[model samples]
Target: MADNDLEIFLTARNVLVELRLNLAKAVSAGYKKGETETAVKSLIEVQQAIDVIDHASEELEELDEAEHDED
Candidate 1:
């Protein structure tokens, strides 16, 4: 992978991690505030975001491996 692509991937991964953490905190706070419905919705959205990021990461790894195989 190119240096810029690697940098972008790392940055995106970091952002996703931070976002997940923040969403978890929101879920907890929402529950404490008795907003169960909103909390559940936020949790679902968070899970979706996590799944997308995981899928993308896997695809990137596969692409990187294929690039290596061509050498």
Candidate 2:
């Protein structure tokens, strides 16, 4: 794989992990404080992170296909 593709993949994966951890923390804190809104917001953030990673993966796949076409 190209260096750029590898970097993008790694960054996206890391961001996804970060988001998951953040969501978990938010849920824990929210429960402790009895704040449902905070937990819901955290869930939304997790979904956004997932969408970003999915888009990055799709773009990488397209780039790979284009590169293969030139071979």
lDDT of 1 at 61: 79
Runs with alpha carbons beyond 4 Å of true place in candidate 1 = 1-3, 6-10, 30-34
Residue 18 accuracy (lDDT) in model 1: 80
What C-alpha RMSD separates each model from the true structure?
2.9, 3.0
* Residue pairs in candidate 1 whose N, alpha carbon or C atoms collide under 3 angstroms: none
Backbone clashes (count) for model 2: 0
- For model 2, residues 1-71, the per-residue Cα lDDT tens digits are 66577577768778877877877777766465546677677778877877777787787778888999999
Global fold similarity of model 2 (TM-score) = 0.58
**Model 2 alpha-carbon drift over 4 Å, by segment:** 29-36
Give the whole-model CA lDDT for all candidates, comma-separated.
Answer: 0.70, 0.75
Judge candidate 1 at residue 11 and give its lDDT: 78
